[model samples]
Target: MVLPTLDKPVGQCLTNLRRPGGLGKDPERAQRRAEQLAAVDPDWNPGALGWTVDWQRHYTGLTLLLEGGAGLEEIVPGVTHRGDDIGRWLARQRRDWARLNTEQQHRLGEMGVKPVARPQKTATRTNTKTGATKGSDAFTRGVAALQQYIAREGTTVVSRSHVERLPDGTEHRTGVWAANQRARRDKLDAAQLSMLAALGLEWAA
Candidate 1:
């Protein structure tokens, strides 16, 4: 059986459904519930709302009653729902809707409710370019080496070039030009830094 399509945007559809004596028939309560649900859902969409064919069949008689209220009596066709069956389905819908927290409910808002996309879980990152892996024995050793190096030679001291004057008063020899140069000369470079990072270790600047 062909189920009716809901071309109206979700928000509008919900607004209509939640109005007093409206389609869903729950009134102001429905709108407040819808808003609460939307606020909690980061990926909430204002489109795509409707009841499934199965639901329509299950609530066929009730749907007929509700459709009359909403002027949509002809949407579902040829489903014979008993009065007892309709009463049971309506009770279930009420119970289910009442149980919703709007914060915790995933997709049970109404028929045709689609779940918003959940953020993807990221895997532990590996940097092959620098050969860095967290919690590895190698990484741990690298951090230890860095700590030892730092302890032996405190913070990087800016090495000033030693200006030597020749017999003629001309500069003869000069020391390292920059502190970074001194660091490199002392064997502290990107390799050590990468290792420290991999082991989640922080070094004093």
Candidate 2:
């Protein structure tokens, strides 16, 4: 801090400032002691005292950012050191959670009653072990046989269930029976069918 000057008040002031015990001065012994202390911090000059405190403040801020107090927020419950409520935070949490082992996620789901992925239900058709294929009823076969017989015999016989609404109206036969029935209800009188079977044919449904 001292500057050379002419022999005057300025000269005296400069001499005082340049003395070894001046405010910015260090003697040989003090310099050696400071060097010993600051050798452990090779990047710094121990003579610059302000650098130490400024460096400490910077380190504290960095630590705070990593210890959940500054910068961003981490919305992932207990998983991160940051505290950012970004738009994708929840989605990120879900992805991270899913990255855990299967058993771990399973345990979490069990704890929270979360629904696990399930196999999708499929459209299934039963494989019948026996009997006719679909759209073919026992009664249908019987009616077909009856129709063939009537066509051969050239005669009309009444079905007990059908005795009204004569379609032929030639004082002819009457019925609500359809000529082209694709579906049939398979019902037969068991006792009557048994009697018919005892005499001859089997009437089955």
Candidate 3:
């Protein structure tokens, strides 16, 4: 598909390859475009046709026509242009075609192209205490230990009430509770604190 020129250069369009409205976003269109790209015959000739912008335009249009099943002889000159210049140029392109630049060639190759191979990211668990990558077992054990400790000593109290007015003019109330986990650690004796320190935890506050 011939995309319209945007605020940025055409080359930058490739940066948004899989984003919304990009060529690869629609699976069906992407597949069809890939088929068209792969169908391009590498043996086609580029004769004396030099690299002019108008010539390039006609050349691109001709290639698109060829992809759509127009044979060499079926591609007439006058059909591509309102003026005689493009018609004459197109007539010569039947045999005397100009070679496309690298950018155009690259664009042709990107049509429905498969994703290139790359290294995949591996999932890992981080050890919060050691700040290093470790097995999930260790992480899970740490979390469970912390949770058990918190449940054993954490003290909770109703801190406030949340009230809201209903459409029927009735008031709905919900209690908000606060827990003091640190106070539990602060209440530990020196011997308990020493035990926790030996276990490599900050449970003694």
Candidate 4:
């Protein structure tokens, strides 16, 4: 049985089949087909398992590595298989462990996966002369401004001329910054993009 990848037509077919008016329209046939697929691979429907197929694909790769006698320590970041970054996915799974459902956590536990420990935050030194905290980059400043804008306005729809002022008296051209970020999104890393998406930037997603 062929497993579905995120970009594959088979994956799209599976997604379509799970829609309300799709396979469920014919309960009997759907059950029969589901059973057939399950007989080959019980995890044929990862959505039902409370995760995305992209997640499942990377997980399957991890399991394959483990089955082939790879140690957990060997699965650090930068490890790749079939174009999927197994190590990065595993790290995310560990870092975002709280976001996983009970069953998902159980499944990962069965594979000896555990939550990663969060690093302790060090205190930042303030510029006493200027009365402002230092060391924030442009992107970091923009995200902070966007967050403040959302808190005040209840949305991320900033006008082209919108300006957001920070508590430290710094002004950020929020709208222009957002537009620039979206335009150069391809250069952003996954964590950076995820942060923007969490702040309600749909384009970042």
Go through the candidates in order and give the C-alpha RMSD of each one to the true structure: 27.8, 43.9, 28.3, 10.3
Better by TM-score, candidate 4 or 2: 4
Stretches of candidate 1 off by over 4 Å are 1-52, 66-84, 98-205
Q: Write the per-residue lDDT of candidate 2 for residues 94-174, one digit (tens) a residue.
A: 334532345534543543423335467675556652343343443344444443333222223435354332223322122
What is the alpha-carbon lDDT for the whole of candidate 4? 0.74
* Residue-wise C-alpha lDDT for candidate 3, range 1-205, written one tens digit per residue: 3356566554344324322444576789977754563476321112112123233445466567668766555545455533323333443432211223454445434532122343576765544534533433333333234322222222111234533343456543312211222346565445344333322233431
- Candidate 2 has a TM-score of 0.17
Ten residues in sequence with the least summed lDDT for candidate 3:
42-51
Candidate 4 lDDT score at position 146? 81
Candidate 4 collision pairs = none
Off by over 4 Å in 4: 1-12, 119-205
The lDDT, on a scale of 0 to 1, for candidate 3 is: 0.38
Off by over 4 Å in 3: 1-50, 81-87, 94-205
Tell me each candidate's TM-score: 0.18, 0.17, 0.22, 0.55
Q: Which residues of candidate 2, in runs, are more than 4 Å off? A: 1-26, 42-55, 60-205
What TM-score would you give candidate 3 relative to the actual structure?
Answer: 0.22
How many pairs in model 2 have backbone atoms within 3 A of each other, for residues 3 or more apart or on separate chains, i.e. clashes? Answer: 6
